[model samples]
Each structure stands twice: as structure tokens, then as C-alpha cells.
Target: MDRQEDRHRLDLRLALADLVADTAACVRFFSRLPVPKLCSADDPARLPDFSQISRAIPLAGIVVAMPAGLLVLLLGLSQLPTLASGFLVVGMLAMVTGALHEDGLADVADGFFGGHTPERRLEIMKDSRIGAFGSIALIVSLGLKAVLIAALLDRYTPLEAMVILLGAESLGRTLIVWQWSTLPAARPDGLAHRFGVPISKTFKQACIFGAACLLPTLPVLPLPSLALGLILAPLAAHGVGMLAKARIGGFSGDVLGAVQQVGTLVFLAGCLAVA
Candidate 1:
């Protein structure tokens, strides 16, 4: 009876681990983890904790999205004769990310650029209606990415483009992590705080994730260009951090999403300009 009880306890522990892992897995993909019914939105007691979980979703988004980009490159190359398919593959991958960050990017552009005060800016961002600025920003950002990727496809071999896309996505998400670590939450209770909640990350974990992202990229470009990409990662993060601080007095979910989207685009633009 004692042995059976011990085994049952262990099984319960394992099940709990699986559940938490599911939550973390969702965070890794969505960058906004959803709260379970146990912590319903209506329950004020759950609000504080649920808020943190929600913000971690974008981190997960980066983790999952990078591989999707690589898959697109692989499939596109496999069907090289059908070049149009490559564009569709990439577009589909973007959709998989739910375009959460892209939407935030457009909203931020519209709100920040259109409004003169912080209150007005935040209000504009909160509005569901997209404005002229948001629409234009979205079109330009997406168009630039498509154009740049297509051009690279036309010129470079499949392997080279795949590496770049993967590297950019990983590096861009890493920037979000970096930004989250350094900045204060813009509001007393906003989505970004969950990620910004300071936790000690080990150097080993950093290197492991960094190596996973950068190693594949090393073979694509020359040593010098690879170095440039590495250098730009920190620089871009810092630039966005400054902008975010200046705008909202700190970072929010929108700012984090904007950082990832802008950082990825900036890296891609750099790759194209140099090549």
C-alpha cells in the first residue's frame, strides 16, 4: 500500500509538470499565454498572476516562429521551379505567428506618431480601428520583408536564404528577451510586466539559445557579415529600448512586439543592403 501511494504521488507530480510545460510551451509560441479557467479574468485574485503569464507568450512566439521560417525556406527550395510557392510559404509562416506583433507595430506607429500626449497616444493604440498611419506602416513593413526575401531568393541559393531568415528571427526574439530584462513596465499593470518580471537567467542558457540561433547562420554569410549581424542584435535592442523608454516611460506589450518586428526587419534590411 505504501509503495502504491508513493507511485501515485510521483505520477501526480509528473502530470503537474506536463501541465506547467504546456503553459510554458504556449508562452514560447504565442508570447501571450492564456490563463486557465482556474484563474478566470473575472476573479480579481487571479489578475496579478495571470497578467505575468500573458506577457510571456511572445517569448514562446519567437521560439516556435523561427523554425517555421526555416521550414518555409526548405519547402521553397525543394520546389525551386515554383518560386511563387516560396512567397506563399513565407506568408503562411507569418500567419502562423498570428501577426500579433505586426498588429502592435502598426498600432504603435499610428498612436505614437498621431498623438501629441501620452494619454492620447495610449487611447489611440487601444482603439480597435486602424488608422491611416497604421495601414501604411503595415503595408510598408510587410512589403519590405517580402521584397527583400524575394530578392534574396532570386540571387542566393536556398540554403543561404534559409540561414538568414532563421538567424534574423532568432536574433529578433532574443532582442525581445534582452529588452524585457532591462526595461521597466510602462504601466502598473500591463502585459509586458510578465516578461519584465526579473528572473535570473544563467549564462549557459543564453549561450545554448544563442548558439542554436547563430550556428546555422555562420555558414551562410562570410565571417565579416556574420559578425555584423551579431553586433547589430545588441545595437538594435538598445535603440528600441531607448525609443520605448522615451515614448511610454517604459516598455509595454506593444513595445515588445514592435521591437521584435522592427528588429527582424532591420536585420533583413541590413543583410540586403550589404549583400
Candidate 2:
């Protein structure tokens, strides 16, 4: 029965393989974290299942944002001005994520506000060049985030500040997944289209995963912060999604990025309010 045992063993190994691959795939896709090897030269099509991997986006957020939060914490401990610490934290996030969300925000602003029609809007979004609308929107969005993060530093202990940062990161990314799951891709091809839309099942799992990622800080985070983050983040996502659907015909990669940027601000504001 050695052959039978070998077949059973192979089945178990295949089953166990998915547990790690799914999480690694999300982390690899969203951040610069050194996740498990995902690419297969042997078979290019044998890639990680992004549909399943979407469920781990929030968990990936924790991995991605930790360094930025820790840097801010250390800066605060060193008696740096709150503004500088906030600025550094924002910089860290941009550097780590390659400013993908920020890029998305600018593109969405340029496309949605600059274009006269849906077709024109999608074309504008695809352009790499930033315009006046994008310039203004990025400045406004980033400025608000920096100011609010500074407010958090002023209102709470360094440890709590880190917790708040983590919560915001997790919540912001969850919104991206939620938006992607619900909205149709606005264009025939692009980053967002290549990624494809997540199904309802994936969306629900992502929400649960995002919430679970915040569990460590639940005891220390202000009750109001918790409540507000939940409410505000989704509202931000839904509002932006609705706007994209109406303006551009549906969501694009840029729309996903824009929502994450916007959702982070609202989520942080809500949490900072009760902090």
C-alpha cells in the first residue's frame, strides 16, 4: 500500500499549500513585504488565485503599515514635533506602497473632474501626466491626512497612536477590496481590470479578515474610534464608488486607489475624534 500512502500524502500537501499561498499572494500584491515565492517560471499561468488572495488584504495592511507606524512612534518618543512625525509616517507609507493609492487618487481626480464624458474620463485616467485637478486633489487629501495624524499624536500616547495607525491601514485596505468586489471595471484593460473584480463571497471574507486584523487593538482603541472607523470607512468607499460608477461608468484601478486614500482620511478622522 506504499503507492496508496504516497497518493494520500500528495493530496494533504496540496491542501496545506493553499493556506500559505493565499496570504502570501495578497501581501505580495499589495505591499513590498517579502512574502512566499509566488511566481512560477515553469508555468506562467499557474499564478496565485487573486480571488482567494483578496481575503487577506487587511492582513497585508498590518504587515505593510507596521514600519511606518513604528517610525512615527520612535519619532514621537524622540520629542519631534507632531507635524514632523506625521509627515514622516505619511512618507513611509508612500514609499512602502510605492504610492499606488496616491497615484490612483490623482488619476481619478483628473479623469472624473477633467473629462466631459465617460469615455473621455477613462482615457484621461489612463494618462500618466497629472493635471490641475489631480494636483489639487492630492494636495488636499494628503494635507488632511497629515494634519489628522498629527492630531492623533497630540491626543493619545505613542502606543495608542500606533494602534490607530494600524486600525486605519487595515480599514482603508478593506474598503479597496469592498469596492472592487461590488463595482464593475470601468475599462476593458488596465491594472484594475487585470486584477478582475472580486465576487460577493470574497468581499465578505475580506471584511471579516479586516475586522480580525484590528482585534489586537480593540481593548485600547477608544470605543468611539472603533465604531466610527467601521462606519466611516465603508461610507467613504460607497460614496466614492457611487461617484465613480456615475462619472466613469464604473470603478478603475485609480478609483480603487482614490477610495483607499479617501477612506483612510475619513477612517482616521472618525477614530481621532473619540481618541
Candidate 3:
């Protein structure tokens, strides 16, 4: 009995350590923010296995966005111009995330729109050059985000606005689990291939993460209105998945990024409308 108890405790300790490492890996991958220095020797590098870290991806989003959210709140409360504050928050987040998702949005726009064939589309996305399609998409998406943030500033108190931002960021990352779960890689290489599909169990854990993100803000929000905001995420993801199926025949890294970007926009938009 003593031996069994020790073994169980040992196992639990190892699991917790792995969780901390994976969380650090995720934060490093998803943001430019400095990590906690617990794993200083390796925290800057992207870890080999994203699947192990998938569970923390949503939390990573909250981690990355919180600073930007705070900045927005500060600016709003200080009586800065709403649109200017919104754009600054958007730009700051772009920098903080190393423009990862925005890059994906541009690549997806160029690939999905510019390629006459699926192979051509995938090739274009990999080119790293911005085309007319990518240019327009970047401008539009950024514009939309700024507009939404500004609208939220007008509609809610600074703290309430921050809640919407936090929830949207968390929920948006969680929504990527659907893309990974439902789709295959567009090519035989790259992130979609490397990470593969997260198992059903993993996917469910992501949903729980997203729920944890949203539930905290619920007390301040109307249930019916919050439902309206919450409903946009999956519906938008379904639409993104369907388009990927028809166009690329599967998801690529760009598709995953596109999902996050769209999820962010629609979730915040829903919250604004409902609020």
C-alpha cells in the first residue's frame, strides 16, 4: 500500500510538470511575450510536439491578449479617441502575437482566392508574397477588428469591454480544435501534418477550456445576449471548414489561422451586438 501510494504521487507530479512545460511551449509558439523563465533554457524555441500542448492553446490566447486588453481599457478610461484606441490595441496585439494569425489570414486570402487549382492555391500560400487578394483581406480584416473594438468601447464599460476581448481571444483559440479535429492537412508537410488531428478527447478538453473562458464573464452579461455571441464561433468555424473542404480539400496552417482570425472577429461582434 505504501509503495502504490508513492507511485501514484510520482505519476501525478510528472503529469503536472508536463502540463507546465506544454503551457510554456504554447505561450512561446503563440506569442512574443516573455515566458516565466521556469524553462529558460528552452522556452524560446517551439517545441517539437504541439499535440501535447494543444490543451493549453486557448489559455495561451488569453495570456497573449490580456496585455492588449489592459491597454485598450486604459486608453478608453483615459478618454482617448475610441477609434484610435481600437486601432492601437489591434496593432499592439498584432505585434504581441508576432502577426501569426494575421499572416495566416493574408496567406489564406491569397491562396484561396488567387489559385485556380488546389495545388496552385497551396503553392501560393507558401510563397510569402502578398498578392492583391491578400492585401485586400488584411486591410479588411484589420479594419473590421478595429471597428468592432471601438464599438465595444462605446457600448460597454472599460472593464466589460475587456471581458469581451478576453473571452473572444480564449474562445477563438479553442475553436481551432474543431479545424484540427475535422480536417486533414492540405499538404503532406507543415503544421497540419506535423500536429495531425487532435483526438476526440483532446477536442472535448478544448471546448471545456473555451467554456471556462466564457463562463467567468457571464455574470455581467445577459444570458440571451451572451448566447447570441457564443453561437457565432462554431457557426463561423463550420463555414470556414466547409470552404476549406471545397477549395483546398483540407486544412493547412493558413486555414487554421483563418479560423482563429474569423473566430475572433465574429465572437467579439456577437458580444457587441448583444451587449
Give each model a TM-score: 0.73, 0.88, 0.91
lDDT, candidate 1, residue 167?
70
Model 1, 175-240: lDDT tens per residue?
665676678777776764443342334223333454576676666777766666667756876887
The number of the candidate with the highest lDDT is 3
Question: Model 2, 23-135: lDDT tens per residue?
Answer: 66666666666655653312223454556667778877888888988986887787788988888889899888888899999999999999999999998999999999999
- TM-score of model 2 relative to the true fold? 0.88
TM-score of model number 3: 0.91
Root-mean-square deviation (CA) per prediction: 6.3, 3.7, 2.4
- In candidate 3 the C-alpha lDDT for residue 214 amounts to 81
Estimate, for each residue in 1-275, the C-alpha lDDT of model 3 and write its tens digit.
Answer: 99999999989877767666766777787888888655433454554465656877787788889998898789889878888889999998899989998999899899889999999998999998899999998899899999999988888788988888888888888988778778877788778566646777777877787788887778767776678778887799778888888898888778888899998898777776753
Better of 1 and 3 by lDDT: 3
* Ranking of all candidate structures by their TM-score, best first: 3, 2, 1
CA deviation > 4 Å runs, candidate 2: 1-17, 34-48
lDDT of 2 at 26: 66
Model 1: weakest 10-residue lDDT segment is 38-47
Most TM-score-accurate candidate: 3
